[model samples]
Target: KGWGHGIKTTCVTRLDAFVSPEGKMYYHRCSVEEVIGRKLGPDDNLASAKNWARQQVLEGKDWRGKPAKFDPDARLFACLSQGEKEKLVEPGAFHVAVISARRGSGIV
Candidate 1:
């Protein structure tokens, strides 16, 4: 269920933490590709690169991190609005499928 290999080339410069309305915390690790839509080069500045990554997410591009696999049923969840998604991920609503980028096989 995980992306076959690591696609990032820079260290995470910042972590964006989200607190669900119900009090759960989710931290998103920003990646270089998520920022610039490409891999990082040797000359890339870790600090500046991370800021760019953060901006992309803030701007609504879905470049959060490495790709992962999720339950097929999760597609239905996609129809949920952002507020609904937060509620579902709360302490209890139903089983939130484990989203992974390392599982090679399963009901992805």
Candidate 2:
């Protein structure tokens, strides 16, 4: 099910941060590619990404330094809504996914 809008790229800019449950912040310089997936619209791509993240957690893999809730480097918290933050999973093992980059740098 889709709205039938073909995926297209439009130049844009956004400021975002990835945070941990503990309040540590990781800055993310978002790009259209990182925010949107290839061959799929942003909505579809984001859904896929979320599903992938859930799978990673279920696989018993350590997220540390990568992008899992249990990961020491998972910065998803920064973007999470306040209500979502209140429901954070594995609060004990959350950590910021730090990134250092200059302005206008691409994620990939």
Candidate 3:
């Protein structure tokens, strides 16, 4: 779902020509492992660490750069929109509706 009635997509910028020794590495994902006290496997999804690592790549582009794939501005905007949606809708309404639904019934 979008943030509003007409909002459809949030476009993030990407840098493909970046070059560095650690440009393609996800090293900061190690922080997530450190925080959780374990080493993550290749398939582990470290959402926060992933974003942070991408931001680091952008920064390593010879100057301070922003993470184009996970733009923090867009994140903040989406969060605000989600907060408004939460405020407007009853928190338990969806759960209540689910509990009230008939089980094993086909679409009517």
Candidate 4:
């Protein structure tokens, strides 16, 4: 979504901020119109854009100001220890388990 491709030209933008536990703050500009394509119905456009924006806010914070080489594998178990950080599990067997648990209603 960062590339110029697949982005709408006339759109409103927003600056989102995130503060980590260490009190460091990070900010990024987000384009809402680019996220809502013309192909979508009016209601669908709003719902899809909102969902995509929320997911972007969540995942963007996870990688903010970090090197591209950051290895999330190093912190898998650590995040699991904190129930609130369970969203961190992804891209591997842990992610599979999470999907399974969600389907099984083991997680809300």
Candidate 5:
């Protein structure tokens, strides 16, 4: 069910107010992990994240801050994307996940 998906320590240099599709996914994952207080494993139930987000949204905000469409801050935090073509294509066929990272975020 996967092809070239991975989370390596690749230092992408940029502060262009956006992140790549894959990059969005990474940040989104990080956001979820931050909320849940742990890193997700490959075998974890990803839908659980969605469920938790939905619960949060119903209570107040849509925790799933989709790339470009939402910010990973504020009430409705915008995170990243998964393999869902529907959510993936929400921004556009070729869209970038807008972000507001400080300078040298790419360096680590």
Candidate 6:
């Protein structure tokens, strides 16, 4: 089972894409790994890395008002919207990777 904004108890077997509030596309890394039957190494692109970092900062806020750390395994890519094209391409637009998993659920 999965849980998040507009998502609940959902099953993701493939690389399901999700759009962030800032209009970025995030894909399930596990699903991608499953499809390719292999794990992915870091590509080390500056934009992608910055996007991931920014996302973490935005999503790291917990309900209890504590800073939370983002998951490392949730690989995501930013899909630049028309408005975000330039900003996303430039450096430092706050972001991070988030992955939701439930106890005993293989939905990660």
Which candidate tops lDDT? Answer: 1
Query: TM-score for all predictions?
Result: 0.24, 0.24, 0.18, 0.20, 0.23, 0.19
Steric clash count of candidate 3: 0
> Which of 1 and 3 is ahead in TM-score?
1
In the range 54-107, model 1's lDDT, one tens digit per residue, is 665566543444333447767888788889777665446566566676885677
Worst window of 10 by summed lDDT in candidate 3: 1-10
User: Which regions of candidate 2 deviate over 4 angstroms?
Assistant: 1-44, 63-108
Q: Could you list the CA RMSD of all candidates, in the order they appear?
A: 17.3, 20.4, 15.5, 14.3, 19.8, 20.3
Ranking by lDDT: 1, 6, 2, 5, 4, 3
Sorted on TM-score, best first, the list reads 2, 1, 5, 4, 6, 3
Off by over 4 Å in 4: 1-38, 61-108
- Give the runs in model 1 whose Cα sits over 4 Å from its true position: 1-43, 64-108
* Local accuracy by lDDT, each model: 0.47, 0.45, 0.42, 0.43, 0.44, 0.47
lDDT per residue as tens, model 5, 1-108: 110123345547531122222434434545556655777686655455446545555666432334224444444333433443335433456856656576647844
lDDT of 6 by residue, 1-108 (tens): 011122223555433453333434446656545554677576523456456556656777442334776665343334445575544443465668566654546654
Which has the higher lDDT value, candidate number 4 or candidate number 5?
5
In terms of TM-score, the best-performing candidate is 2
Compute the lDDT of residue 27 as modeled in candidate 3.
Answer: 26
